[model samples]
Target: MRYSLAIMAIALGIGGAQAQVSPPLQVQEIGSFHVGGRVVALGDMPKREIIPSPGAPPIQMDPNGEFQVEQMYAQYIKLAEPRARYPLLLWHGGGLTGVTWETTPDGRPGWQIYFLRQGHDVYVSDAMERGRSGWARFPEIFASEPVFRSIGEGWDLFRVGPQSGWNPKAAQRRAFADTRFPLAAWDAFARQSVPRWTTTDSQIQAAYNEYVQKVCPCVIIVHSQGGNFAFNAALAAPDKVRAVIAIEPSGTPSAGTDASPLRGVPHLVVWGDHFADSPFWQKIRNNVERWAGAIRDMGGTADIMDLPADGLRGNSHMMMMDTNSDEVAGRIQAWMARRGLMR
Candidate 1:
């Protein structure tokens, strides 16, 4: 069930206000469910009614369960004839939304618009819980189980075994225990709810087949954990995807697995140099490069981009949201242009 980027944009253009600088984004709850249940709404607010950010338009959601903001900016319509442009699917990292790809902290136009200006149709979204998209549904499922709850409580639980604790750790007694169960539950909920989160490698391939047959074959741009999902998806439909660009992707799904997906697709792996400072940086990078090499070895194009060792600071995970994000965006543009993906 694929929809054209143009149709999505128009549908999303209906109610949201413009963007603002300070709050940048505003999420309003138009409706709610039971206590401790989820709330259906316009923006990214948790409880309480959300206020619109100054200069930003109010967000809107349609009765069909489609989030308009994601459609409007992330999924773009071609300005010229549809045949003349390429389609691109952009996925952000964990805890972020499609808006993060389109707007900076100051609320000005961001990367999605940059790609739009370059003449490519794009679709972006908050993987699941980060943005105006459904938040409660996921939490409810994760909150149902204790093991899953622990997995969801901290970051990197999925990558490093759960024993790593909330901060970071080495191998543990059990991969499930090291991670917060709540977090795992959340991830499971996301996979079950999001159309893109296919449970098995074969399902991902099926999704690609459907996308290619229904929509224009697209270039997949994934950041962080999305890199994992996109890779698996591409592995499933190598013939349908044009290319893959991953930004600071997390390392998982060991390269040695016989089911190692992404065996024969053009791929670009971008990593923030700050990751070098982490104690586990070497192991993580090795895993990432090994996977990249595997893709290339299987006849897929693969490359890696390491951010300036000192240019972008803070946590390595924060590189995407850093003040110098434009630099990253520019590099992405260059990469796309080099691949002839940009129109």
Candidate 2:
């Protein structure tokens, strides 16, 4: 029960009206840490030539800068006065930043605030090489060029609807029809998508390991591509990670990988709807099922949540950005309490 008048008031979205919630968080701290090798030399790189005026021609500069910089960047916002036994750390999927946990595409609150209000110190991170964590030049630092996500890809992959066309309006229509994602905020969500480099996974995973080591005995909530990193983080430092909530993780520990480290640690694997209809997603579901079984065999408490099975249906791949996101967060909060992680 502490207050900070300068920063306490925040508007809460309930029933379409504004209600100010004072001190949504007791303490908020923001910072960053660099990782991996640094490039000491300034070098030439390609850029779009912009002509200033009719008489002034396009300018091409070579070896323009002279400063050392690192490729991996790790930024975080730590909220204090937590009611949970350990801090809750949120890791976003590929091509996204910590914004994934702060606001939905449709302009709703994200899980970061949800958990904070529930009395848990929270740490929302922008993983290395994404968002605030930066990237080095392709062919220089990265093995390949970064790949960008398109609206069609997002719609198909995120289970928003059958492949929408490339046009923004068409995608918007599809998103509206999907009824899972906040259609009005579809463009906003799309704006957050960024390029990602698969070649940098090792560096990214290493940074994740360091982050977990630096802040341990904490609960990790991971989404999409973040699932594997979070899973491995728990495995790498079993004594440090108390619980894991993998939301539709992209991959998992192989059946042969030893999950014994997770013994007595609560783990939850949550799945959204529309997977059975998609052959591609079905395989993913099958893989995670086996992985969960493997962890159980190794003496860990692993529970699975198939949203449709629980009567919550029509959820897209981006469940955190779905219309009923708060409902989903509520379920997760209850799960934490049931596991005794909540105070």
- The superposed Cα distance between candidate 2 and the true structure at residue 213, in angstroms, equals 1.0
Candidate 2 lDDT by residue in tens digits, 256-336: 888888886789989888785579889887887888888899888989988889989888888998988889989999999
Alpha-carbon lDDT of model 2: 0.78
Give the candidate number with the greatest TM-score. 2
The CA lDDT at 214 in model 1 is: 50
Clashes of 1: 30
Candidate of highest lDDT = 2
* Candidate 1 off by > 4 Å: 1-77, 81-85, 128-216, 257-264, 309-316
Residue 329, model 2: Cα distance from true site in angstroms? 0.5
lDDT per residue (tens digit) for residues 5-80 in model 1? 4355556763244422221112221221111122344434344333368877656533334231211112344444
Candidate 1, TM-score vs. the true structure? Answer: 0.55
Q: Which stretches of candidate 2 lie above 4 Å from their native place?
A: 1-24, 28-32, 35-80, 164-167, 175-178
